[model samples]
Target: MAEEETELSDEQKKEIAKWFLLNAPAGEIQYVAKDLKSVLNADDVYNEAASEAFPVYNKSHMICLGMSGHFGDVLVTSYGELNENEYLDPKTAQVAIVDHVKQVCTEVRPATDEELPSPYIEEYRCALEAEMLKYVSEAYPKGVCSVYCINGKDAEGPGSDFELVVVISAARLSPQNFCNGSWRSIWNIEFKDDIQSLELKGKLQVGAHYFEEGNVQLDTKHECRDSTIFQSPDDSAIAIASVIRHHETEYLASLEESYLNLPDTTFKDLRRKLPVTRTLFPWHNTSQFSLTREISKELGIGK
Candidate 1:
Protein backbone atom coordinates (compact mmCIF):
# COMPACT_ATOMS: atom_id res chain seq x y z
CA MET A 1 0.00 0.00 0.00
CA ALA A 2 1.10 3.58 -0.68
CA GLU A 3 2.09 5.70 2.26
CA GLU A 4 -0.55 8.09 3.51
CA GLU A 5 0.05 11.79 4.06
CA THR A 6 -0.67 13.65 7.26
CA GLU A 7 -3.01 16.62 7.09
CA LEU A 8 -2.44 19.65 9.30
CA SER A 9 -5.31 21.19 11.20
CA ASP A 10 -6.66 24.55 10.05
CA GLU A 11 -4.90 26.42 12.83
CA GLN A 12 -1.65 24.62 12.19
CA LYS A 13 -1.82 25.18 8.46
CA LYS A 14 -2.76 28.83 8.90
CA GLU A 15 0.36 29.44 10.97
CA ILE A 16 2.47 28.14 8.11
CA ALA A 17 0.32 29.94 5.57
CA LYS A 18 0.87 33.23 7.34
CA TRP A 19 4.62 32.85 6.87
CA PHE A 20 4.21 32.14 3.18
CA LEU A 21 1.85 35.03 2.68
CA LEU A 22 4.14 37.43 4.50
CA ASN A 23 7.07 36.35 2.32
CA ALA A 24 4.98 36.51 -0.85
CA PRO A 25 5.73 39.26 -3.33
CA ALA A 26 3.64 42.40 -3.54
CA GLY A 27 0.14 41.90 -5.06
CA GLU A 28 0.30 38.14 -4.54
CA ILE A 29 -1.62 37.89 -1.28
CA GLN A 30 -4.64 36.32 -2.92
CA TYR A 31 -2.58 33.67 -4.64
CA VAL A 32 -0.63 32.79 -1.50
CA ALA A 33 -3.75 32.75 0.71
CA LYS A 34 -4.77 29.41 -0.79
CA ASP A 35 -1.86 27.37 0.54
CA LEU A 36 -3.62 26.91 3.86
CA LYS A 37 -6.57 25.25 2.17
CA SER A 38 -4.37 22.64 0.60
CA VAL A 39 -2.33 21.98 3.74
CA LEU A 40 -5.31 21.72 6.05
CA ASN A 41 -7.31 19.30 3.96
CA ALA A 42 -10.34 21.06 5.42
CA ASP A 43 -11.42 23.84 3.11
CA ASP A 44 -14.49 24.65 5.18
CA VAL A 45 -12.50 24.96 8.39
CA TYR A 46 -9.84 27.10 6.73
CA ASN A 47 -12.53 29.27 5.20
CA GLU A 48 -14.25 29.69 8.54
CA ALA A 49 -11.10 30.48 10.53
CA ALA A 50 -8.04 31.32 8.51
CA SER A 51 -9.40 32.93 5.34
CA GLU A 52 -10.42 36.25 6.88
CA ALA A 53 -7.87 36.09 9.69
CA PHE A 54 -4.86 36.59 7.46
CA PRO A 55 -2.28 38.52 9.48
CA VAL A 56 0.49 38.40 6.88
CA TYR A 57 2.03 41.75 7.71
CA ASN A 58 5.01 43.82 6.59
CA LYS A 59 6.37 47.36 6.74
CA SER A 60 4.61 48.12 3.46
CA HIS A 61 1.22 47.47 5.09
CA MET A 62 0.28 49.97 7.78
CA ILE A 63 -2.62 52.18 8.94
CA CYS A 64 -5.18 49.50 8.04
CA LEU A 65 -6.63 49.08 11.51
CA GLY A 66 -9.24 51.75 12.26
CA MET A 67 -9.62 53.32 15.68
CA SER A 68 -13.13 52.05 15.95
CA GLY A 69 -12.18 48.97 13.89
CA HIS A 70 -15.69 48.47 12.49
CA PHE A 71 -16.63 51.69 10.76
CA GLY A 72 -14.28 52.74 7.99
CA ASP A 73 -12.89 50.22 5.58
CA VAL A 74 -9.26 49.28 6.26
CA LEU A 75 -7.68 51.88 3.98
CA VAL A 76 -4.14 52.30 2.64
CA THR A 77 -2.37 55.60 2.95
CA SER A 78 0.83 56.78 1.23
CA TYR A 79 4.40 55.69 2.03
CA GLY A 80 7.17 57.87 3.46
CA GLU A 81 10.44 57.98 5.44
CA LEU A 82 11.90 59.92 8.32
CA ASN A 83 15.23 59.69 10.30
CA GLU A 84 16.52 56.34 11.61
CA ASN A 85 16.12 56.90 15.39
CA GLU A 86 13.28 59.25 14.57
CA TYR A 87 12.33 56.84 11.79
CA LEU A 88 8.79 56.03 10.60
CA ASP A 89 8.38 52.39 9.70
CA PRO A 90 4.87 51.80 8.39
CA LYS A 91 4.58 48.39 10.05
CA THR A 92 5.77 49.59 13.47
CA ALA A 93 3.77 52.76 13.07
CA GLN A 94 0.72 50.68 12.20
CA VAL A 95 1.14 48.62 15.35
CA ALA A 96 1.72 51.74 17.41
CA ILE A 97 -1.18 53.63 15.79
CA VAL A 98 -3.67 50.80 16.06
CA ASP A 99 -2.60 50.01 19.60
CA HIS A 100 -2.86 53.66 20.56
CA VAL A 101 -6.39 53.91 19.25
CA LYS A 102 -7.24 50.70 21.01
CA GLN A 103 -5.94 52.10 24.27
CA VAL A 104 -7.64 55.50 23.94
CA CYS A 105 -11.04 54.08 23.14
CA THR A 106 -11.14 51.95 26.26
CA GLU A 107 -8.70 53.42 28.80
CA VAL A 108 -9.73 57.06 28.56
CA ARG A 109 -13.42 57.69 29.12
CA PRO A 110 -16.05 59.57 31.12
CA ALA A 111 -14.71 59.32 34.68
CA THR A 112 -17.81 60.59 36.47
CA ASP A 113 -21.47 60.80 35.60
CA GLU A 114 -21.16 64.58 35.30
CA GLU A 115 -18.35 64.26 32.76
CA LEU A 116 -19.60 65.94 29.59
CA PRO A 117 -17.08 64.88 26.93
CA SER A 118 -13.89 63.01 27.66
CA PRO A 119 -11.12 65.49 28.43
CA TYR A 120 -8.52 63.41 26.60
CA ILE A 121 -10.49 63.08 23.38
CA GLU A 122 -11.44 66.77 23.39
CA GLU A 123 -7.84 67.99 23.40
CA TYR A 124 -6.83 66.08 20.28
CA ARG A 125 -10.15 66.90 18.64
CA CYS A 126 -9.52 70.59 19.06
CA ALA A 127 -5.90 70.44 17.94
CA LEU A 128 -6.71 68.24 14.94
CA GLU A 129 -9.60 70.43 13.82
CA ALA A 130 -7.33 73.45 13.96
CA GLU A 131 -4.85 71.81 11.59
CA MET A 132 -7.55 70.73 9.14
CA LEU A 133 -8.92 74.28 9.11
CA LYS A 134 -5.57 75.42 7.68
CA TYR A 135 -6.32 73.53 4.48
CA VAL A 136 -9.12 74.30 2.04
CA SER A 137 -8.04 71.04 0.47
CA GLU A 138 -10.77 68.72 -0.86
CA ALA A 139 -11.10 66.63 2.34
CA TYR A 140 -11.57 69.43 4.83
CA PRO A 141 -13.18 71.90 2.42
CA LYS A 142 -15.09 74.57 4.29
CA GLY A 143 -17.81 72.88 6.32
CA VAL A 144 -19.34 72.54 9.74
CA CYS A 145 -17.37 69.60 11.16
CA SER A 146 -16.83 67.27 14.11
CA VAL A 147 -13.55 65.86 15.46
CA TYR A 148 -13.02 62.84 17.69
CA CYS A 149 -9.61 62.76 19.28
CA ILE A 150 -9.23 59.07 19.78
CA ASN A 151 -6.19 59.67 22.03
CA GLY A 152 -2.58 60.77 22.38
CA LYS A 153 0.19 58.20 21.88
CA ASP A 154 3.77 58.54 23.07
CA ALA A 155 6.58 56.02 22.62
CA GLU A 156 9.95 56.54 24.34
CA GLY A 157 12.83 54.64 22.80
CA PRO A 158 16.56 54.76 23.68
CA GLY A 159 17.26 57.93 21.72
CA SER A 160 13.90 59.64 21.32
CA ASP A 161 10.31 59.98 22.39
CA PHE A 162 7.60 59.49 19.74
CA GLU A 163 4.33 61.21 20.36
CA LEU A 164 1.41 60.27 18.15
CA VAL A 165 -2.15 61.43 18.19
CA VAL A 166 -4.93 59.34 16.68
CA VAL A 167 -8.17 61.00 15.66
CA ILE A 168 -11.16 60.73 13.34
CA SER A 169 -13.02 63.53 11.50
CA ALA A 170 -16.36 64.02 9.81
CA ALA A 171 -17.74 66.75 7.56
CA ARG A 172 -21.38 67.68 7.14
CA LEU A 173 -23.55 66.47 4.29
CA SER A 174 -26.88 67.67 2.82
CA PRO A 175 -29.84 67.42 5.12
CA GLN A 176 -31.90 66.85 1.97
CA ASN A 177 -30.52 63.37 1.63
CA PHE A 178 -32.56 60.99 3.82
CA CYS A 179 -29.50 58.83 4.43
CA ASN A 180 -27.57 61.67 5.99
CA GLY A 181 -24.16 60.54 7.15
CA SER A 182 -20.91 62.46 7.09
CA TRP A 183 -17.78 61.38 5.20
CA ARG A 184 -15.20 60.04 7.68
CA SER A 185 -11.42 59.31 7.99
CA ILE A 186 -8.86 58.37 10.68
CA TRP A 187 -5.35 59.81 11.28
CA ASN A 188 -2.09 59.34 13.23
CA ILE A 189 1.00 61.59 13.40
CA GLU A 190 4.24 61.40 15.29
CA PHE A 191 5.01 64.50 17.37
CA LYS A 192 8.75 64.74 16.89
CA ASP A 193 10.57 67.49 18.73
CA ASP A 194 12.71 68.34 15.67
CA ILE A 195 11.84 65.46 13.39
CA GLN A 196 14.35 63.34 11.47
CA SER A 197 14.68 60.05 9.51
CA LEU A 198 14.88 58.66 5.94
CA GLU A 199 13.23 55.22 6.11
CA LEU A 200 9.82 54.46 4.57
CA LYS A 201 6.71 52.30 4.92
CA GLY A 202 2.89 52.18 4.31
CA LYS A 203 -0.18 51.67 6.52
CA LEU A 204 -3.96 51.06 6.44
CA GLN A 205 -6.51 51.46 9.26
CA VAL A 206 -10.16 50.67 10.17
CA GLY A 207 -12.07 51.36 13.40
CA ALA A 208 -14.87 49.96 15.59
CA HIS A 209 -16.37 50.73 19.03
CA TYR A 210 -18.12 48.45 21.47
CA PHE A 211 -18.97 49.13 25.10
CA GLU A 212 -17.77 47.26 28.16
CA GLU A 213 -19.75 49.42 30.56
CA GLY A 214 -17.24 51.33 32.73
CA ASN A 215 -14.44 50.40 30.34
CA VAL A 216 -14.16 50.96 26.59
CA GLN A 217 -16.30 48.65 24.53
CA LEU A 218 -14.92 45.13 24.57
CA ASP A 219 -16.06 44.37 21.03
CA THR A 220 -17.72 46.23 18.12
CA LYS A 221 -18.92 43.25 16.12
CA HIS A 222 -22.61 42.87 16.82
CA GLU A 223 -23.47 39.18 16.96
CA CYS A 224 -27.15 39.95 17.48
CA ARG A 225 -29.15 42.98 16.29
CA ASP A 226 -31.22 43.34 19.44
CA SER A 227 -28.09 43.51 21.60
CA THR A 228 -26.58 46.32 19.52
CA ILE A 229 -27.78 49.68 18.25
CA PHE A 230 -26.85 52.20 15.49
CA GLN A 231 -28.55 55.58 15.36
CA SER A 232 -28.25 59.10 14.01
CA PRO A 233 -29.83 61.18 11.27
CA ASP A 234 -27.89 63.14 8.61
CA ASP A 235 -26.94 66.15 10.67
CA SER A 236 -24.96 64.15 13.17
CA ALA A 237 -23.95 61.74 10.44
CA ILE A 238 -21.86 64.17 8.37
CA ALA A 239 -20.04 65.54 11.39
CA ILE A 240 -19.10 61.98 12.22
CA ALA A 241 -17.85 61.33 8.68
CA SER A 242 -15.61 64.43 8.47
CA VAL A 243 -13.89 63.59 11.73
CA ILE A 244 -12.74 60.17 10.54
CA ARG A 245 -11.61 61.54 7.17
CA HIS A 246 -9.68 64.33 8.85
CA HIS A 247 -7.74 61.85 10.97
CA GLU A 248 -6.01 60.18 8.03
CA THR A 249 -5.64 63.38 6.03
CA GLU A 250 -3.89 65.07 8.91
CA TYR A 251 -1.80 61.97 9.62
CA LEU A 252 -0.63 61.67 6.01
CA ALA A 253 0.14 65.37 5.71
CA SER A 254 2.14 65.27 8.92
CA LEU A 255 4.39 62.55 7.49
CA GLU A 256 5.24 64.41 4.30
CA GLU A 257 6.04 67.95 3.27
CA SER A 258 2.75 68.29 1.32
CA TYR A 259 -0.16 66.41 -0.23
CA LEU A 260 1.67 64.90 -3.19
CA ASN A 261 1.40 61.36 -1.77
CA LEU A 262 -2.30 61.63 -0.88
CA PRO A 263 -3.65 60.26 -4.17
CA ASP A 264 -3.01 56.65 -3.06
CA THR A 265 -5.49 57.22 -0.20
CA THR A 266 -8.29 59.47 1.11
CA PHE A 267 -7.55 62.72 -0.71
CA LYS A 268 -11.07 62.47 -2.12
CA ASP A 269 -13.86 63.66 0.12
CA LEU A 270 -17.37 62.25 -0.38
CA ARG A 271 -19.79 62.78 2.50
CA ARG A 272 -22.91 62.67 0.35
CA LYS A 273 -22.60 59.00 -0.51
CA LEU A 274 -21.22 57.67 2.79
CA PRO A 275 -23.53 55.47 4.87
CA VAL A 276 -23.34 56.30 8.58
CA THR A 277 -24.27 54.79 11.93
CA ARG A 278 -23.56 55.75 15.55
CA THR A 279 -21.37 52.93 16.87
CA LEU A 280 -20.98 54.31 20.39
CA PHE A 281 -23.41 57.06 21.38
CA PRO A 282 -27.10 56.96 20.61
CA TRP A 283 -27.59 59.80 18.14
CA HIS A 284 -31.32 59.65 17.40
CA ASN A 285 -32.33 56.81 15.04
CA THR A 286 -30.22 53.70 14.66
CA SER A 287 -28.10 53.44 11.48
CA GLN A 288 -27.48 50.08 9.81
CA PHE A 289 -25.23 50.78 6.90
CA SER A 290 -22.78 47.84 6.82
CA LEU A 291 -20.13 49.78 4.91
CA THR A 292 -20.19 52.61 7.48
CA ARG A 293 -20.27 52.96 11.28
CA GLU A 294 -20.75 56.02 13.49
CA ILE A 295 -18.81 55.82 16.74
CA SER A 296 -19.44 59.37 17.80
CA LYS A 297 -15.72 58.58 18.65
CA GLU A 298 -16.33 60.74 21.69
CA LEU A 299 -16.85 57.73 23.91
CA GLY A 300 -13.44 58.15 25.53
CA ILE A 301 -12.97 61.84 24.82
CA GLY A 302 -14.67 65.01 26.10
CA LYS A 303 -16.26 62.96 28.80
Candidate 2:
Protein backbone atom coordinates (compact mmCIF):
# COMPACT_ATOMS: atom_id res chain seq x y z
CA MET A 1 0.00 0.00 0.00
CA ALA A 2 1.24 3.52 -0.83
CA GLU A 3 1.94 5.87 2.15
CA GLU A 4 -0.71 8.55 2.67
CA GLU A 5 0.38 12.23 2.41
CA THR A 6 -1.06 14.51 5.11
CA GLU A 7 -2.53 17.76 3.74
CA LEU A 8 -1.68 20.80 5.85
CA SER A 9 -4.51 22.78 7.48
CA ASP A 10 -4.93 26.57 7.18
CA GLU A 11 -3.59 26.98 10.71
CA GLN A 12 -0.59 24.84 9.86
CA LYS A 13 0.03 26.84 6.70
CA LYS A 14 -0.13 30.06 8.75
CA GLU A 15 2.43 28.67 11.19
CA ILE A 16 4.71 27.86 8.28
CA ALA A 17 4.29 31.38 6.94
CA LYS A 18 5.20 32.88 10.31
CA TRP A 19 8.29 30.68 10.51
CA PHE A 20 9.46 31.79 7.07
CA LEU A 21 8.67 35.42 7.82
CA LEU A 22 10.95 35.35 10.84
CA ASN A 23 13.72 33.13 9.45
CA ALA A 24 14.05 33.85 5.72
CA PRO A 25 17.49 35.06 4.62
CA ALA A 26 18.25 38.68 3.97
CA GLY A 27 16.81 40.07 0.67
CA GLU A 28 14.86 36.83 0.10
CA ILE A 29 11.48 38.45 0.74
CA GLN A 30 12.15 41.31 -1.66
CA TYR A 31 13.45 38.95 -4.35
CA VAL A 32 10.40 36.73 -3.95
CA ALA A 33 8.10 39.72 -4.22
CA LYS A 34 9.83 40.70 -7.46
CA ASP A 35 9.55 37.18 -8.82
CA LEU A 36 5.86 36.95 -7.88
CA LYS A 37 5.22 40.28 -9.60
CA SER A 38 6.63 38.88 -12.84
CA VAL A 39 4.53 35.73 -12.39
CA LEU A 40 1.35 37.74 -11.81
CA ASN A 41 1.93 39.88 -14.93
CA ALA A 42 2.63 36.86 -17.13
CA ASP A 43 -0.24 34.68 -15.85
CA ASP A 44 -3.87 35.72 -16.27
CA VAL A 45 -5.23 33.09 -13.87
CA TYR A 46 -4.39 35.14 -10.73
CA ASN A 47 -6.74 38.11 -10.38
CA GLU A 48 -4.71 41.31 -10.00
CA ALA A 49 -5.55 43.10 -6.76
CA ALA A 50 -4.42 46.64 -6.01
CA SER A 51 -2.12 46.93 -3.02
CA GLU A 52 -1.35 49.80 -0.64
CA ALA A 53 1.86 48.15 0.53
CA PHE A 54 5.31 49.47 -0.31
CA PRO A 55 5.94 50.42 -3.93
CA VAL A 56 8.13 47.34 -4.40
CA TYR A 57 5.35 44.87 -3.52
CA ASN A 58 2.68 46.54 -5.65
CA LYS A 59 0.88 44.11 -7.99
CA SER A 60 2.67 41.08 -6.43
CA HIS A 61 0.89 37.79 -5.64
CA MET A 62 0.30 36.79 -2.03
CA ILE A 63 -1.67 34.34 0.14
CA CYS A 64 -3.23 36.26 3.01
CA LEU A 65 -3.12 34.41 6.33
CA GLY A 66 -5.48 36.66 8.26
CA MET A 67 -8.23 37.47 5.73
CA SER A 68 -10.06 36.01 2.79
CA GLY A 69 -8.65 37.55 -0.37
CA HIS A 70 -7.85 36.88 -3.99
CA PHE A 71 -4.42 35.93 -5.43
CA GLY A 72 -2.99 39.48 -5.55
CA ASP A 73 -5.06 40.96 -2.71
CA VAL A 74 -3.62 40.86 0.84
CA LEU A 75 -3.92 43.33 3.69
CA VAL A 76 -0.42 44.06 4.99
CA THR A 77 -1.08 45.93 8.25
CA SER A 78 2.65 46.56 8.89
CA TYR A 79 6.04 45.23 7.81
CA GLY A 80 9.70 45.25 8.77
CA GLU A 81 12.99 43.42 8.35
CA LEU A 82 12.86 40.01 10.03
CA ASN A 83 15.19 39.73 13.00
CA GLU A 84 16.08 36.10 13.58
CA ASN A 85 16.95 36.82 17.18
CA GLU A 86 13.36 37.85 17.86
CA TYR A 87 12.00 34.56 16.53
CA LEU A 88 11.71 33.02 19.97
CA ASP A 89 9.44 35.81 21.25
CA PRO A 90 5.76 34.99 20.66
CA LYS A 91 4.89 38.66 20.18
CA THR A 92 7.32 38.74 17.27
CA ALA A 93 5.31 36.02 15.55
CA GLN A 94 3.75 37.80 12.56
CA VAL A 95 0.61 36.93 10.61
CA ALA A 96 1.50 37.44 6.95
CA ILE A 97 1.26 35.76 3.56
CA VAL A 98 3.92 33.40 2.20
CA ASP A 99 4.78 31.75 -1.13
CA HIS A 100 4.60 28.09 -0.11
CA VAL A 101 5.44 26.95 -3.63
CA LYS A 102 8.66 28.94 -3.58
CA GLN A 103 9.15 28.30 0.17
CA VAL A 104 9.86 32.01 0.86
CA CYS A 105 8.19 35.00 2.49
CA THR A 106 6.61 37.59 0.22
CA GLU A 107 6.42 40.91 2.12
CA VAL A 108 6.48 42.32 5.65
CA ARG A 109 5.62 45.96 6.19
CA PRO A 110 7.32 48.38 8.65
CA ALA A 111 7.88 46.94 12.10
CA THR A 112 4.91 47.57 14.33
CA ASP A 113 5.54 48.43 18.00
CA GLU A 114 4.46 44.92 18.98
CA GLU A 115 6.75 43.15 16.48
CA LEU A 116 10.11 44.75 17.35
CA PRO A 117 12.32 43.94 20.33
CA SER A 118 11.90 46.23 23.33
CA PRO A 119 15.35 47.85 22.97
CA TYR A 120 14.94 48.57 19.25
CA ILE A 121 11.51 50.18 19.28
CA GLU A 122 12.67 53.48 20.83
CA GLU A 123 15.59 53.92 18.44
CA TYR A 124 13.23 53.40 15.52
CA ARG A 125 11.42 56.58 16.58
CA CYS A 126 14.17 58.83 15.23
CA ALA A 127 14.34 56.99 11.89
CA LEU A 128 12.80 59.84 9.93
CA GLU A 129 15.15 62.58 11.18
CA ALA A 130 18.19 60.36 10.69
CA GLU A 131 17.31 59.52 7.07
CA MET A 132 16.45 63.11 6.11
CA LEU A 133 19.67 64.40 7.66
CA LYS A 134 21.65 61.84 5.67
CA TYR A 135 19.85 62.64 2.43
CA VAL A 136 20.19 66.46 2.63
CA SER A 137 23.79 66.35 3.86
CA GLU A 138 24.81 64.01 1.06
CA ALA A 139 22.74 65.62 -1.71
CA TYR A 140 24.00 69.13 -0.96
CA PRO A 141 27.32 68.58 0.85
CA LYS A 142 28.73 71.84 -0.58
CA GLY A 143 27.93 73.70 2.68
CA VAL A 144 24.20 73.56 2.08
CA CYS A 145 23.56 71.85 5.43
CA SER A 146 25.26 70.54 8.57
CA VAL A 147 24.69 67.41 10.71
CA TYR A 148 25.33 67.35 14.47
CA CYS A 149 25.15 64.12 16.47
CA ILE A 150 25.07 63.83 20.25
CA ASN A 151 25.84 60.74 22.33
CA GLY A 152 24.19 60.37 25.71
CA LYS A 153 22.77 57.85 28.14
CA ASP A 154 19.20 56.66 27.66
CA ALA A 155 17.61 57.97 30.86
CA GLU A 156 14.29 56.23 30.33
CA GLY A 157 15.07 52.70 29.11
CA PRO A 158 18.06 50.34 29.18
CA GLY A 159 17.48 49.67 25.49
CA SER A 160 18.98 52.97 24.32
CA ASP A 161 21.99 54.95 25.54
CA PHE A 162 21.88 58.02 23.29
CA GLU A 163 19.56 60.64 21.81
CA LEU A 164 19.77 62.12 18.30
CA VAL A 165 18.51 65.64 17.47
CA VAL A 166 18.66 67.01 13.91
CA VAL A 167 18.61 70.63 12.77
CA ILE A 168 17.97 71.89 9.21
CA SER A 169 17.09 75.15 7.52
CA ALA A 170 13.36 75.61 7.12
CA ALA A 171 14.19 77.00 3.70
CA ARG A 172 15.56 73.63 2.65
CA LEU A 173 13.10 71.27 4.39
CA SER A 174 10.63 72.22 7.07
CA PRO A 175 10.76 70.67 10.55
CA GLN A 176 7.00 70.23 10.43
CA ASN A 177 7.51 67.44 7.91
CA PHE A 178 9.38 65.34 10.43
CA CYS A 179 6.96 66.08 13.25
CA ASN A 180 3.90 65.50 11.08
CA GLY A 181 4.09 61.69 11.18
CA SER A 182 4.18 61.51 7.38
CA TRP A 183 7.54 59.85 6.72
CA ARG A 184 6.37 57.89 3.67
CA SER A 185 5.74 61.09 1.72
CA ILE A 186 9.29 62.32 2.32
CA TRP A 187 11.30 59.18 1.51
CA ASN A 188 10.78 55.42 1.40
CA ILE A 189 13.50 53.56 3.30
CA GLU A 190 13.86 49.88 2.38
CA PHE A 191 15.81 48.86 5.47
CA LYS A 192 16.06 50.91 8.67
CA ASP A 193 19.31 51.41 10.60
CA ASP A 194 19.92 49.41 13.73
CA ILE A 195 21.01 51.60 16.63
CA GLN A 196 23.66 49.94 18.79
CA SER A 197 24.72 52.01 21.80
CA LEU A 198 28.02 50.12 22.03
CA GLU A 199 29.12 50.81 18.42
CA LEU A 200 28.24 54.48 18.88
CA LYS A 201 30.89 54.87 21.59
CA GLY A 202 33.53 56.33 19.23
CA LYS A 203 30.91 57.75 16.84
CA LEU A 204 29.16 61.09 16.95
CA GLN A 205 25.40 61.64 17.26
CA VAL A 206 24.59 64.04 14.39
CA GLY A 207 21.62 66.40 14.91
CA ALA A 208 19.92 69.15 12.90
CA HIS A 209 17.79 72.18 13.94
CA TYR A 210 15.69 74.35 11.65
CA PHE A 211 17.24 77.75 10.86
CA GLU A 212 16.06 80.70 8.79
CA GLU A 213 18.32 83.12 6.87
CA GLY A 214 21.58 84.67 8.20
CA ASN A 215 24.60 82.67 9.46
CA VAL A 216 23.88 79.65 11.67
CA GLN A 217 26.11 77.53 13.85
CA LEU A 218 27.61 74.45 12.14
CA ASP A 219 29.32 73.01 15.21
CA THR A 220 28.75 69.33 14.44
CA LYS A 221 30.14 67.02 17.15
CA HIS A 222 30.78 64.08 14.81
CA GLU A 223 33.96 61.95 15.18
CA CYS A 224 34.29 61.05 11.50
CA ARG A 225 34.20 64.39 9.60
CA ASP A 226 34.25 68.14 10.11
CA SER A 227 30.86 69.71 9.18
CA THR A 228 31.72 73.30 10.19
CA ILE A 229 32.31 74.31 6.57
CA PHE A 230 28.55 74.14 5.92
CA GLN A 231 27.58 77.66 7.03
CA SER A 232 24.70 78.78 4.82
CA PRO A 233 22.94 77.93 1.57
CA ASP A 234 24.19 81.07 -0.18
CA ASP A 235 27.76 80.48 1.02
CA SER A 236 27.60 76.99 -0.46
CA ALA A 237 27.31 78.52 -3.91
CA ILE A 238 30.42 80.62 -3.23
CA ALA A 239 32.29 77.57 -1.95
CA ILE A 240 31.32 75.67 -5.10
CA ALA A 241 32.68 78.52 -7.25
CA SER A 242 35.94 78.61 -5.28
CA VAL A 243 36.45 74.86 -5.68
CA ILE A 244 35.73 75.05 -9.45
CA ARG A 245 38.20 77.92 -9.91
CA HIS A 246 40.73 75.97 -7.86
CA HIS A 247 40.22 72.97 -10.19
CA GLU A 248 39.49 74.92 -13.38
CA THR A 249 41.21 72.55 -15.82
CA GLU A 250 39.50 69.26 -14.98
CA TYR A 251 36.10 70.74 -14.02
CA LEU A 252 35.90 72.95 -17.12
CA ALA A 253 36.57 69.92 -19.33
CA SER A 254 33.81 67.99 -17.51
CA LEU A 255 31.49 70.99 -17.85
CA GLU A 256 32.10 71.21 -21.62
CA GLU A 257 31.37 67.50 -21.92
CA SER A 258 28.09 67.99 -20.08
CA TYR A 259 27.11 70.81 -22.43
CA LEU A 260 27.99 68.92 -25.62
CA ASN A 261 25.28 67.33 -27.80
CA LEU A 262 22.56 69.30 -25.98
CA PRO A 263 19.94 71.71 -27.19
CA ASP A 264 20.85 75.40 -27.21
CA THR A 265 19.31 77.58 -24.47
CA THR A 266 19.82 81.16 -23.23
CA PHE A 267 22.28 81.92 -20.39
CA LYS A 268 19.38 83.01 -18.20
CA ASP A 269 17.50 79.85 -18.96
CA LEU A 270 20.64 77.79 -18.40
CA ARG A 271 21.29 79.50 -15.07
CA ARG A 272 17.69 78.85 -14.07
CA LYS A 273 18.19 75.16 -14.82
CA LEU A 274 21.64 74.99 -13.18
CA PRO A 275 20.35 72.45 -10.67
CA VAL A 276 20.00 69.95 -13.53
CA THR A 277 23.30 70.96 -15.15
CA ARG A 278 25.52 68.08 -16.17
CA THR A 279 28.47 70.13 -14.84
CA LEU A 280 28.79 72.49 -11.90
CA PHE A 281 29.85 75.87 -13.29
CA PRO A 282 31.40 78.67 -11.21
CA TRP A 283 28.12 80.56 -10.95
CA HIS A 284 29.25 82.38 -7.79
CA ASN A 285 32.67 83.45 -9.10
CA THR A 286 31.82 87.05 -9.99
CA SER A 287 34.96 88.98 -8.86
CA GLN A 288 38.56 88.67 -10.16
CA PHE A 289 38.52 84.87 -10.71
CA SER A 290 35.27 84.36 -12.66
CA LEU A 291 34.08 82.03 -15.46
CA THR A 292 30.43 83.16 -15.41
CA ARG A 293 30.76 85.65 -18.30
CA GLU A 294 33.27 83.59 -20.28
CA ILE A 295 31.05 80.49 -20.26
CA SER A 296 28.05 82.63 -21.25
CA LYS A 297 29.93 84.14 -24.21
CA GLU A 298 31.15 80.69 -25.24
CA LEU A 299 27.54 79.52 -25.25
CA GLY A 300 26.74 82.38 -27.71
CA ILE A 301 24.80 84.46 -25.13
CA GLY A 302 25.08 88.25 -25.58
CA LYS A 303 26.22 90.53 -22.74
Candidate 1 lDDT tens digits, 126-232 = 45445444432455452322232222322122233232222223323232331222233323333223343211111333222222243221111111010111112
Please give, for residues 16-103, the per-residue lDDT of candidate 2 as tens digits.
4434333322223444345444644433222122121222231121112222222222222112213321111112233334443343
- What TM-score would every model get versus the actual structure? 0.27, 0.18
Best by TM-score: 1
Instruction: List per-prediction Cα lDDT, in the order shown.
Output: 0.33, 0.31
- Which regions of candidate 2 deviate over 4 angstroms? 1-113, 117-124, 127-303
Q: What is the C-alpha RMSD of each candidate to the true structure, in Å?
A: 24.1, 20.9
- Sliding window of 10 residues with minimal summed lDDT for model 2: 179-188
Residue 215, model 2: lDDT of 22
The positional error of residue 70 in candidate 2, measured at the CA in angstroms, is: 25
